[model samples]
Target: MTEESSDFKFNYFFGLVNLVAVFLIVWFLWYIFMNPNTVMKLYTPMYGFSLIVVFLSGIILMAKVLKWPAWYNRLFQKDKPITKGILLTIIAFLLMIGLNYIVFWGFIGKFGIAYFSPDSIVASGGIGAEPFVARENASTAIVYFFTAFLWMALFWDLGFGRWPWQNDTYGVQAWSKLFAILFFVVLFYILLFHSHVCYLFYPAQDKAAVTPWWEELAGTGSAFFSLGLILCTLVWIVFSDLLWEGKPWNRYEVDGESTFGKGFVVFFSTLTFGIILIFILLMIFNYVWMEPFVGGQYTDGPDWRYIHAGEIAGFFILAAFIWKNYFNNFPNLDSLWLRALIRSIIAVVLGLLIYWFYYSPLATFFLAKVEGFAQPGDTPLVWALLFLSIILVQSEFFDGWPLKRKK
Candidate 1:
C-alpha cells in the first residue's frame, strides 16, 4: 500500500475498535440495564492503584496499536508545527460541544415540542424535580458521554485516519489522533461535573449517592503538591539547561509553543480545584449537594464524586507546564503576539457562530424556558480570549492569525 493508504488503514482500525466498544457498552446497557455498581467497578481505581490501565488500555489502543510513532512526537517535537493540531482540535471541540447541546435539547425537549423529563432521562419519571441537578447524575453521563464520542471520531481520524475505510491526512500527523479524542471524552465530563450542568436544576436529589473515591485515591491532601512535583519533573526534563529562560513554574500560552507551563498549571489548578471545590461546595450546601436525589443511603455525596477529574487531571496540568518550559515566555506581540491574538478572535467568532447556528436553537427550545439559569458576567474576558485564540492560530499556523490568511 502507498504511505497515505497505509496510514489510513492504521487510523481506522482503532476507530472501528472504539466504535465496537461503544456499541457493546450500549448493548450491554440496553440488556442488563443501568447497574451503577457495575459501571463504578469498571471506572474506579483501588487502593490508589487505578483502573486507568483497563480503560486507557481499551480506549487508548488507537495510538500504540496503530504503531504511530509520531503520536507523542507531534506534541514535543522541536520542528513540527503544533498550530495545525491546535486549530483542528479547537474546531473539533466546537463541533463536539455544539452537537452535545443539540442532542441534549432533542432528548429533553423531544424535539421543539416537549420539555425535559427526569422520568425519561433517569428512567424514574419526569423533569419537574425541585432540585433537578442532584437527581440527574446519570443524565449528565449519558448526554455528555455520547456527545464526546462523536468528537472522538475526529481525533481518531488522525491516529487511524490512515485506516482502510476513509484514510486521509489534513493537519496532525496520523499517529496522534487517538490521544486527541481521548482528551476530550475525559475533559467534557470534567467540565459538566464542575458546572453541575443540565441534569436537573441546582440542589439535585434521588439520583444516587457517592463515596470518597478521590479523597481516597489522591492519598488525602497531597493532590496539588504531587501535581507540583509532576510540574517540576517536566520542567527539569524539557529545559534542564541553564539556557531555558522561560518561567518553568508559570502557566500561559507562548507563540509557536505548547504553553505547557501555563496549561499544566491551569490543568491542575483549575481542573483539580474544580473537582475539589465541587466536593467542598456540595458538602457545605446541603440544599445543593443532595438536591438531585431525594435522600439516599448517605446524606453526603458518594466517593464517585471525584472520578471525572481524578487521575489525568494532573496530566493537563503537566501539559501547561511543559508548554511554558518550551516556549519560555510570551512574545512582545511584534511578529507572534498579533497572530496569537487574532486566532483567539476567530475561535470566538467561530464558536459563537456555531453556538448561534446549532446550540442556540436547542437552548431556546429546552433551556431558554427556564429562567434564573443564566449567569451573565465575564462576557468581555471570554470574548477577549476568543479573539486571542484567533491571533494564536494565525501566529502558529498561517504565520498570522488573520481573516485574510489562507484557509
Candidate 2:
C-alpha cells in the first residue's frame, strides 16, 4: 500500500482495537463496582485506577501512536513510537492518579461543592451508601468533570474552530485556544450557577429536604450538577461524529475554516436538531411504551430514564454514522449520497438495537448481578459518557494540541 493508505490502515486497526478495549474496561468496571456484595472490595481504588488507565491510554495513543502534533516529541526526546507511547503512558498514569486523588477526594469531597452535595447523592440512588462514591458525589463528580472538559475541548474549542483561532498570528493560535477554554469555563460557571436555563430541564425541588448548601443556592444544586452531566452527553452526541469524521451537514467550506457567523449557525443548528430529534424519540417511547404501562398517568416532569435512553440512542446513531463516513470498512459505492443514505439507515438500526439491548439484556444482567444498582438510572450512562469523553479528548485535543494543520 502507499504511505497514506498504510497510515490509514494502521489508524483504523488501532481505532477498532481501542474501541473494543474501552468497551471491555467499561463493562468490567461496571460489573465489579456496581455489584453491591463485592463493590466495597475495590470500589474507591478501582474507580480512580480505571480512569487513570483510560485517560493515559488515550493521551498516549494520540500523542505517540498518531503523532499528529510535533510537540509530543519533546516528552521523552524519543524517536521510536513504542518508546514514546510507553513513557508518556507511564507519566500520564502517575499524574492523573495523583490529580484524581487530590481533586476528587481531598478537595471536592471534603468541601462538598459542585457535584458532591450530600442530599443530591441520595436522591439519585446512592452509590455504596458512602459519601464519596454516592451519586453526584466525589467519584462521580470527577468522572463527570473529565467528560465535561472533553466536551468543552472538543466541541467548542477544536471542532468549532475556536482553537487555533483563524484570525490570530502564527504564534498566537495556541494562546487563543487557551483563552477559548477559559471562556468555556466561564460559560459553564454561568450556566451552572448564574442562569435558570438548566433548571428548565432538571427542575429544582423544594428546599425542605435539601442540604443547607443546596437551599442557599435556591435548590438548584442537583439541577446544576445534573445539567453538566446531561449537557456533556448531549454535546457529545451532537458533535462527536460530525466534528471528527462525518459530513451530514456542510458546516464549513474547508476543514478548520469557519467564521463566527458560519460557526454559530452550524453549532446552534446541529445542537437544536439533535435536541429536537431526541425529544421526539423520547416522546414516542413515552407514549408507546411508558404511558401504557403506567395507566396513562405519565407526568410531564423530567423522566431521567427516558432522557438517558435518548442520549444513548443519539450516541449510537452518531457512532454508526461516523463508522460509515470516516471508516467505511465496508464495500465502497460510487455514489456518495447513496453511501450516506445507507449509513443513515445503519444509524437508525444501530440506535434501536442499542436501546433494546441496554434496556433489556444489559439491564437484566446488572440488576441480577448487582444489588442496589439502578439499571434505569444515570450511572450506566455516566460511565458510557466518560468513555466517549476520553475518545474526544484524544481525538480533538491531544491529537492536534499546540498545532493546527495548514491547508
Candidate 3:
C-alpha cells in the first residue's frame, strides 16, 4: 500500500479505538460527578462542571489561535504530547476554578452583578430562590457567556482565518483577537442573555435589563432561543469548515488571501444557514412531538422546543468533530459533491442516533437523567459540550497523541 493509504488505514483503526475511549470517559465522568442517580443529583453542579470544561476548551483554542505564546512554549516546548496534555488539563481546570470562584463569583458577582453569585441570587429572593435552583441558574447564565465566547472565537479562527491580524505578531494578534471577541461576546450576552436572565427572578429585574425583545415573537422570555440559534449556527460553521474543507467560503478569497469581505460574508452566510437549519429541525420535532403550544411543558413547550433544537444541533456539531478528527471523515472520494453529500448524511444520522440514545432508557440508566424527552432542568447540551471538550483537548493539547502515528 502507498504511504498515504497506510496512514488512512492506521487512522481509521485507532480512530474507532479513540471513539470508544472517549465514550467511556464521558460516561464515567458523568457517573462520578454529574449523575442524578448518584450523590450530586442536582443540575447546578453539572452546569458548573460543564462551564469549566468549556472554559478549558476556550483556553486550549486560544493557545492554538495565538500560535502558542512564549510562556506556553517555554513550559511545554519539550514535553511529549501526553505529558503536555496532562499538565495543561490540570492547569486549565485550576484556572477555570479560579476564574469562577475568584473573578466572577467572588469579585464581580459580590460587588457588581448579583447574577454571577448564587448566594446573591438567593439572598435577593424571587424566582429560583432555592439554593440549588439559584446556583443552577447562575451557572447557566455564565455558560451562556462562555458559549458566546466560544462561538466568536471559532468564528474568528475559521471564518476570518487570521484576517486583519495577518501582518501582526502572535502576541499582538492574540490580544487584538481576544479583546475584539470579548467585546462582541459581552455585547451579545448583554443583549441576548441578560434580559432573559433578569426576568428569571421574581418581580423581574426590569430596571436591570429591558424586556426580552424576542418575547413577543418567541412566546417566552427565555434565553434558550438565543442558545438554540447560536448552536445551530455552530453546526453549519463546523459543517463548512470540516466536511466541506472550507469550500465556497474559502473560494471567496482574493488573490490567494482570505479577505475581510469574504469573512464577513462567511459570518452572515453561516448565520443564515443556521436559521434555516434550526427551523428545519424544529419542523422535524414538530412532526415527532406535535406542534409545541405556548406555556406547555416538556416537548410541548415552545421554550423547550427551541432549546432542545439547539441541544440536538450540539450533537450534530459533536458528530462532525468526531467524524473529522477520529473517523478520518470517511469515504474519501474523487467527486467533491458526492463526498460532501455522503458525509453530511452520515453526520446527521450519527447525530440523530446520539440524540435518540441520550433520551433513551439507556442514558437514564447510565447518566441518571429523568425518563423521556425534554425533562425540566435537564439538558443534553451539557453532556454534548463535555464530550466535545474532551475531543478538543485530545486534538489541541495532546497533539493527537496515540492517534497520531509516528511521522
Candidate 4:
C-alpha cells in the first residue's frame, strides 16, 4: 500500500481505539458519580444529566460557538495539545461550576427566584417537600432553559456562521455573540418552557407563568414536547454539518457568506424536518411497543414518548460525530447526494446499534437500570449526552490529540 494509505489505516485504527478509551473513561466517571445504584447518586438521572448537559453546553459555547479558546490559543501558543486541552478543560469546568452553583443557585436563588434554589423549593412546602422531587423539578426548569440555549447555539453556528461578528475582534465577537445567544435562550425559555415548568409543581404557579399553549396538541403540558423538537432539530443540524457537509443549507449562502436570509432558511427548514422526524420516530415506536394511550405512564405514555424520540435522536447525534471523527465519515462516493444518503444510512444504523446496546441486558446491569423500555426514572440521554460530551471534549478541546496530524 502507498504511504498515504498506510497512514490512513493507522489513524483510523487509533481513532477507533481512542473512541473506546474515551467512552470507558466517561463510563467510569458516570458509574462513580451518576450511577443510580451509587450512594452519591448526586441526584436523579434527569437532574444530574441536566447539570452535565448544561456544563457541556457552556463548554460548547466557549470552545466551539464563540471560539473563545482560539483567542487564548495565542497565549498558550507553545503548549502541546494535551496540555492545552487539560488547562482549558479545568478552567471551563470551574467556570461552569461557579455559574451553576454560585451565580444561579447562590445569588439568583437567594435574591431572585425561589425555583432556582432547590433549598428554597424544598422549603416552600407542598410537592416541593417531597424527597428528591424538588431537585428534579428545579433541574427540569434549568435544563429546559439550557436546552434552548444549546439549540440557539447550534442554530447560530450552523446558520449564521459568525455573521455580523465575522470581522470583529475575538473579545468583541465572543461577548457579543454570547449576549445575543443568551437573549434568545431566555426568550425561547419563557415562550416555550417556563409555563410548563411552572405547572410542574402542585398548585401550579399560574401567576408566575402562563399555561402551556401546546398542551392540547402535544397531549400534555410537559416541556418534553419542546425538548423533543429541539433534540430532533439538533440531529438534523449536526447531520447537515457532518454528513451532508451543509449541502442545501450552504447552497443558500449569499455571496459565499452566511446572511440573515440563509440563517432563517436553515432555522425553519431544520425545525420543519425535526417535526417530521418526531412523527416518523413516534410511528416506529408504535410498532415496537404498545400504543400510547392517554394517562398512561412510562412506555405507554405520551410525554415520555416525546422525550424518548429525542433520546433516539441523541444517539444519531453521537453516531454522526463519531463517524465524522473516527471513521473519516466513510464511503467517500462521487455523487454528493449518494454520499450523503449512504452517510445518513450509516449514521442511522449506528445510532440504532447504540440504542440497542444502551438498553441491552448487559448495559442494564452495568447502568443499574431495570430491564425494559421507558422505565420510570431511566433515560438514555444521560448516557448518550455524557458520551457526546466526551467526544466533543476530545475533538474540540484536545484537538483530536494522538489522532490529529500535525502541520
Candidate 5:
C-alpha cells in the first residue's frame, strides 16, 4: 500500500518477477491460441533455479508486508505468540469469503446479472462447480496459507537472531512450534473445502479407543493431503537448515555434536512402502465385489477398495508417526542403533494396529456383504501382491536390476 512497500514489494523483487511471469504466461497462452507451433522453449536447470529464488524471495517479501500478526499482534498483545496469526487469518478468510459473496451474491443479487451466478464465476475465471467451489477455495487458500506460514517462520527466526525452527536448538524451538502451527493453518484451509478425499475415517462399530479415527475421517479419499504438504515442507526445511548450518543432520547428540538419523526415517518408512501393491489389488476387487457384498449406505467409497486402501495406508502412516515420535525424535536416547530398534518396534506396532483395525473391517465390509449381505476379492494375486509388499517394507531393502539400492 505504501510507496516503498509497492516498490520493494515489501522485501521481494519477485513481485516484479511474478508480474512478468504472469505476463509471459498470458502471452504464451495467446500465442498458442493463435498458432499451434508458437511456444516458449526454456530448457535449463537455471530456469528452475531462478524460479526457486523468485519463490523464496517472494515469501520473504510477502512476510514483511502481510505479517499482520508478527507486526500488529506483537504491538497489541505481548502474550500468546500465535494470537496475532490466528486473528489475522480469521479476518482474512472472512474477507475473502465476503468478497466472493459480494461478487456473486450481493451485487449479482441486486442486479440479477448472469455475471454473478456461480456459473458466471467459472465463465469469468473463478473456480468451477458446486463441489469445486470448496476445492478451488481450498486451493487458493493453500497458496495464501503457505505465504503466511512459511513467511512468519522465516521472519521470526531472522528477527529473533535464531535459527529456523528446524534447527531444533533450544532457543529456536519456540519458532519451531510456531512454524508447526502455521503449517496446520494451511491444513485448515485445505480440509475446510475438501474434507471428502482426505481418507480420514471413524469406526463403524464405534467406541473402540484403539480404532483409527483418521481412517473414518478419510472416508471420501480426501485424505488431508494438505497436511502431507506441510509435513513434506518441514522435512525439507529441516534438511535445508542443517545444510545452511554446516550440519548434515537436524538433531545433534548430547555428549558432543554428531548426526545419526539422516536416512533412517526415509529408509524405515520405505521398508514398509510395499503396501501399495496390495492396495491396488484389493481396489480392483473392491470395485468388482464390494457393492454386491456390502450393500449399505457407504459414502464415496461404494466399492470398498478405497476404504481398504485407507486402512492399509493408515499402517504406514501410523508407523511414520511412531518412528517420528518415539525414535527418530527420541527423548533421553541418542544412538543410531538404539534409535533404529525403537523406531522399528514402534513402526511394527503401529503397522500391526493398522492391519488389525482398518484393513480387517474394510476387508470384511467389502468382501462379505457382496451388495446384498457382503464384498471385495477372491484372488490370490491380490493377496500375493500384499504379502510381497510386507516383505519389501520389512527388509527395508529396495534396489533394482537397473536401479540404485535403497539405504
Candidate 6:
C-alpha cells in the first residue's frame, strides 16, 4: 500500500473514534441526570442546576450586562475565562445550598412560613424514608413570579435596548420604564394570581374541581400553576430570544427614536405573538408525546413529562446557540445556511443517540452501581426552569460563556 493511502486510512479511523467518544460522553451525562438515586442524593438535580443557573444569572446581570458598578465588576469578573467559569459555578452551588438550608429550611420552614416540609406519607413511601419537601405558599408563589419577571425583563426588555430606562437621562424615559413595569405586573398578576380566568372556560378535570380557588390559583403543587410558570419561562427561552427578534413589529427602537406609543405597540404585539407560539408548541407536545405515554388524565395532572421535554428542548437550542456563537460555527467552511443545516443534522443525530441510550439497559446498569436516595414518580421539573433561566442569563447577560459574544 502507498504511504499516502495508509495516512488517509489512519486519519479516517481517528476521526471515527473521536466521534464515538463524543457520543459516549453525551449519553453518560444524560444517564446520570435520569438516575433517580443521583437526583435524590444531591439535593436533586433540580436544586443543583437551579443553584448554578441562578448564581450565574445574578452575577452576569449585575456585573457584566448591566455594569452596575465598578466594585460589582471587580468582585465577579476574572481575566481568565476558565478560572472565572469554574469559580462562579462553585460559589453559586455552595451559596444556593447554604441559603436554602438557612433561609428556606431554618427560618421560613421553621418559623416565618411553611416553605419546606418533611415528606408526607403520600410523597414519601413511609415515615423514615421521607425526603425534604419544598412546600409552596402564596408568598413563595409571589416571589417566584417576581423572579420570573426579572428574568424576562433582563432578556426581553432591557437586553434588547428597549424602553423606560434603556437610555433615560433626567427622568424623561422614566415613564416608559414605569409603564413597562406596571404592564408586566398586571399581566403576570392575572396569569399567576387569577389563573382561573383562563381555565374557567375549560372543563374542570383532575384537581381543579375539588381544589379551592386560592389553592388552584397560588398553589405550586397545582398542575395548572406549574404549567403556567413553565409556559411563561418558555416565553423567555424559546420565544423571546429565538422567534420574537427581527420581526417587523420589533423594529421600533427605544433610544429617543421611537415614541412611547410605538414602543407600547411593539411590546404588546411581540408579546401576543410569543404567547400564541407557546400555545401551539404545548398543544403539539401534549397531544403527541405526553398524552400517549402518560394517559390523558395524568398528562393533564402535573404535566411534568411535557415540562421535562421542554427543558430538554431548551437545552438543545442552547447547545446550538453555543455552537454557533461561542465556537463561530465550527468547520467554518460553508455558507450560513449550509452551516446551520449541518449543525442541525448533528444535533438531531446526537439527540436520537441520547434517547436510545437513556432507554437502553446501560442506564439501568449505571443506576444500579450508584446508591443514592430514590423517589418514585418524582421528576426534576425545576431543573428545566433553571436551565432556561441560566441560558437567558448567559445569552442575554453574559452573551455566552468563555467569551462574551452577543447572540
Error of 4 at 355 (Å): 0.5
TM-score of 5: 0.27
Residue-wise lDDT of candidate 2 within 1-407, one digit each (tens)? 22222333334555556566656665665566454445543334325434643464345333323332445555444335445444554655565655565554456545654343334444555333445445323344454454444445545432455333566653465555555654774555444432332222233322312332332332223333333334434443443343223354345535647455555655665556655655565567568455322122223223343434445554564455335323432324555456555655565566566556555656556433322212322244444444454444434343311121213
Which sections of candidate 2 miss by over 4 Å? 1-6, 10-70, 73-81, 88-99, 104-147, 157-159, 162-172, 192-256, 291-301, 310-335, 362-378, 386-407
Q: What lDDT score is found at residue 100 in candidate 5?
A: 43
Candidate 6 residue lDDT tens string, 147-180: 4444444444423443435556523443455455
* Candidate 3 TM-score, true structure as reference: 0.91
10 residues in a row with least lDDT, candidate 3: 1-10
13-78 per-residue lDDT for model 3 (tens digits) = 778999999889988877766776666543455464446545655564545455453346565564
Query: Which residue runs does candidate 5 get wrong by more than 4 Å?
Result: 1-79, 82-311, 322-332, 351-407
RMSD of each: 17.7, 8.0, 2.8, 2.7, 23.0, 10.0
lDDT of 3 at 377: 62
Q: TM-score for each prediction?
A: 0.28, 0.61, 0.91, 0.94, 0.27, 0.53
Q: Clashes in candidate 3: how many?
A: 1
lDDT of each: 0.32, 0.44, 0.78, 0.82, 0.34, 0.41
Worst 10 residues of 4 by lDDT: 1-10
Candidate closest to the true structure, highest lDDT: 4
Residue 208 C-alpha lDDT in model 4: 95
Question: What is the Å distance of residue 5 in model 2 from its true position?
Answer: 5.5
- Write one digit per residue (lDDT tens) for candidate 4, span 292-361: 8779877888888899999999999999998888877776766778879999999999999999988889
Query: What is the per-residue lDDT of model 1 for residues 1-407, given as tens digits with 9 covering 90 to 100?
Result: 12222222223344345434433443343223222234432211110011111222222232233322244345655233455445443543454334333443345434421223333443334444433432233333343344344324422332223333223452333335455555766674344232233323333332431322333443332122222232223222222111123233232434423343544453454334444544443344444454323222222323222221221222322223222222222232444435334433433343344334223444333222122212221011112122223333333333221212222
Model 6: how far is 209 from its true place, Å? 15
